[model samples]
Target: MDVADGVLVAGYRIVRRLGSGGMGTVYLAQHPRLPRWDALKVLDDRHDSDSEFHARFLREAELAARLQHPNLVAVHDRGEDHGRLWIAMQYIDGGDLAGLIRRGPQVLTVERAVRILGDAAAGLDEIHRAGLLHRDVKPANILLTTDADGSDRVLVTDFGVAHPIEDGVKQSGGVATTLAYAAPEQFGDGPVDHRADVYALGCTLYQMLTGSVPFPRTGAGSVMYAHLHEPPPRPSAANPQVPKDFDAVIATAMAKNPADRFASCGALAAAARAALTPTPRRRATRLSVAALVIILVAAAALVGVLSRTTPSQARPVRTPVSGSVDGSQWGAFAYIAQAFPDLLPGFPYGSGYEELSGCLPQDTKYNNVPLDTSLPIGTLFCLGNRDPVIDLEIVCNADRTPIQPGVALADFPEGDEAWSRPSGSGHLFWGHTTFTDTGSDLDGHTTGVLEIFFDRADRNFCRIQVVGTPTTGADLRAAWWPGAPL
Candidate 1:
């Protein structure tokens, strides 16, 4: 089999070729046991004839597999089959830096470009720490993937074939068509080092910023001469929006002399980050030393007293969940409607709604209760609607667990924040916690959380959450609740 579609190599089922490079042809393959996919790099059989290269490939494959870093593409498994060397790596769905750059400035903003570079730098530094040099560092070698949580993760690829630091070799001597990213020493007699990769990274950043390579020379002789002699081009000159500091950064990274270049790829990336960051302005006003000392001393005294306390009553464990939860019954809605008819100013803005939800996903907005694992099981939702469509849901469970009073307050951190005692309630005593410190609703706006523990013998365990609009704890508690009237 040609290791084409439907062919199996070392138990990996080949799907299709992802890409090909000088090292080998890459194929998309399915793991033998897992349902997930892997990018399998199979070296050409022609190179397998060289015994020395074969030994090196296996040794380095093992080394690459040993590396475990979030920013580096993980090498999962490697083996030889039918006189071919193959290595399986993590498949990144987000495509390569070259492809992202091809999309131009509309997609690759300066902040995004710097962030991606920082991730690549971290991975590159890790490889260097492992005594390896990624000689061919370019946009094509950088891979991108997004996590399930909607965060972008950039991983470095092709480290399996990277040269060990001991292999001090002259890389780009005479003339080459692909010397666009080659360092100066590559075309000279001096031994090439990690600085070569730094130079290439600088070149990559240049292309990412300007939408074109630093030197677009076509002729082999011209390219060689440019790499050996020409000074690094300024990205700001091409794209005025690029910070001027980046020009100095590129110059240092692509410095003609190896010693003149940055000590490490991380340093270059850090410089780039600094270039992007605006200098912080010094605060003119200063707090008096005596006033600051008094505040600290008072806080220390309060912390000592509060630290000695505990919650009078231990809260009940969460309710057990079964199948999908029923939302049709206006569980908490009926109570809120009677208690505070004005809370949900009906139809004009947001739909009047409520849900008796089981353990909903943490991301769900309709279920406003802050679902801490330690809390009671039942959930009651109340929709007191507002603008850009904001809704409030208060989930309450009927759990009557008795405990002693005067146990002491559980926590008292610095600030005016304190758990106020629920006394003299008319209908429902409101307790509030804001989601600004917690997390946003599904719609990504800050949400506020509330848990109302009714002081009655039954002691209904209630949690209310405001979703959609950014809200303050003090403001929400004072205004949003439906207190006594019902």
Candidate 2:
């Protein structure tokens, strides 16, 4: 019978077919009584008639239901109905990793691959801890969830073919796993363990990083034999950007002999984390040099300006300026609000106000109270090269702001020239030094400081205010850096 002919089973209304796998057909169904959606995997009655397959399938579902991990798909219910076996699971809106890889290679960045693999490994580790082995881990079984915020979440699914350690199945399998990802031992005469899952994870990771499987070949039998006898190719051979350590990890996991692999999936995950850690030394060195150059330039300019002024004139003075928001900065906000209406509502001038200032070379401190938590708002304060002196200072708040205390201005690579635009803002933060003439007489200017304010529900709908001293047309052109293009 066709899937559509099936009635609503146990309050679940099958809306459409999700996909068909080796075990059964999965349907996207919703609960009639509760606000819930699920993927219903119904075993074909034909397969259930085979006692061996039915027993294995039911046992696999029971075993998987007992294993719980954030990355692993959660099973909600399992039972037999009208001669068909069915298992209900969480409905993952996003589909599997195979579709993601097929879209394009560039879509998968190194950082993304590392994160996905690390999360998947953590899931496998949990399964290993439960004394079960996911013998059929592959790209098709990994699901990717893309949230409204654009972040990606990975979910491992399809444990219907997994086996428990206590199950006394013989070395020669009744059911073999995906040929391309199956571990060498699956084809050998031995009982498989957690390492088998680790091997499959390695193959999946290899595919994610390189856009192709390590053992991709013509025939299924040929691929299965290669898993049994051939050494897996290094991922870096296909994508050199993959770190050598990652290649080593993959090689060790996919080793023909189980003794050569990591003892557990947890150990493999730790190694993946280490390989993915950003190179701190290189990033630190680059930031240090950039800070030094900025300090020297500011100091030289400060000295030249101080030379022209007397001591009386050089005495430090605080000046506060305010006006009816009518300037290029306001115009920039207006343009941004219009471009990203969803992110920045009530364009141009938002519900809050922002201010900017340039302090002379000296030590200064800012103590701000944490703005009310109920009101979601942000304020931007910028320090510009007013005196052209190499000055060391700290930007901090004793009780307010999300930025941590004791942040050195020069430590940030972009310096005061960097700005933070709210997530929903179509325009990125602009520093005082960046601007561009956008045809017409109008110019797009970057603010030295930006502040956003909004309520909790509208936190994403904050306003960006910029403050900076005007520069000559030529100087502005020289320093002009435009906001990120939409």
Candidate 3:
């Protein structure tokens, strides 16, 4: 019902209308007992006779009220007044994301898009954790507010289309999804879960980055048909300024097969954050002799200590090789340190390496770290070694394989197996292993030997590969200790 201003609905005094949609009308209302104002949502009076619509309205209130997360809108109370059901929620002064995108340059920056959608992803994860699915997740449904620090805090609002676990994706009627953001499975009768939300979030991220949906609305059923039969257009194609790494993130998130998508909303957000993170690059500068001497002395001392200690009882390195372990070029290191701090042990960042290159697809032609993983098979960070036969390369796995601690080196790369060991926290793995590539992009079936170490915690997939000179597993372990220089 269109209640006039100054009217009371369930003890909340209606001040003015905020907005209205297919679900109901939202009003800015002042609470009777509290001094704060609340957004009062009144269910449509026309649906009072329909039990299904009424139940859906109450379900939204109940589901949202139980979810208590900063990323989600808070539900205060719900009741029926004047034969109309009403739910009171926190009132946000800022407008929705849709309005922001439309008013601005029609798109948001990578940082802002990630920030807004990352928070929204957390809210979606919370909803999934509550055994509920927000079937309708669009930019218009996301409300953005400013925090005390003047930072944007986005909250996922409008749970009117939330589906409970009991529904099992079969809503009796046809797909109840927005055509632009709906997952392919939503079109046909299949089981919908948290992945459906992931698909929609991916679409939302695509819009935020490219200022347009994956598929344009060409006709009545063309967009829906494209979502079912076609692949999503790359965000970079629409906006050249969009980072290349985002292409893979969006592709995986919008994968037609739910099995191919990330396991959860949190995983998708983590991937997006990681994609936006910069990788290490080589700088045009000379290394200091004093720093080099210090690193060499530390490495020598570490080797001597390892000679005495047993493999199982090896000690953790206490001192950093240098103060500049986390350098300006070490962007991936910074990214990992931000999320998983213990994974990176302040290894001298800018001191050792002369040239850093990623193992790209065939004939990619690169002199520096690639901006995206479009053709990345792995990363190779080369150090300036005097002996041509000896290659010291840092292998960062871009294959996205999930390698865990205690796994043998033979299991990961093909070659002669030597030895492998895990760090104290089981987040990093260092192994001196040999592998033979048969017609591969990197080595081309040639038998090669290398000492490899990778971060097994997050999806950074960073690995340190030392080719030539096959040393004992224990020696490699001690030589490449966490805080020691490479």
Indicate which candidate wins on lDDT: 3
Question: How many residue pairs clash (N, CA or C atoms closer than 3 angstroms) in each of the candidate models, in the order given?
Answer: 6, 15, 6
- Best of the candidates, TM-score: 3
Better structure of 1 and 3 per TM-score:
3
Candidate 3 ranges beyond 4 A from true positions:
105-107, 278-486
TM-score of 1: 0.55
Over 1-486, each residue of candidate 1 has an lDDT whose tens digit, in order, gives 135689998889999766554366678899999999999888756566788667766775777876789998888889987778888888887778765664445467888899888889899888888877777677777888788887678888875447777878654424221356788777766677777878888888887776566775323345557788888889988666688889999999989988999999899999999889856332213657687778779989988876675232232211111211122222333332223232321211111222111212222243444433323444334322121113444444424243222211112111122233343231222222333333323232333333333334433333344432224333344333423111
lDDT of 3 by residue, 152-238 (tens): 989999888888877786645555666668898887776888899999999888867765557754222556788888886788766
Tens digits of per-residue lDDT for model 2 on 1-486? 236724686667888767655477778888667799888888854576698878877876788789777898898888777777778888899867765543323456667777777788888888878877778887778888987788778788888677776774346543367666788777766677888888888887777676566665433455667787787888767666667668777888788888899887667767776777746565456567778778779989999987888453665321111112222322322222232232221212111111011111111232232222112222322222111111112222222333321222111113222333454322222223333553311145332432223232223333333333332322221222222111
TM-score (all chains, Cα) for each model: 0.55, 0.55, 0.57
How high a TM-score does candidate 2 get?
0.55
In order, the Cα lDDT scores of the candidates are: 0.59, 0.56, 0.63
Clashing pairs in 1: 319-377, 380-394, 380-395, 380-396, 382-393, 450-464
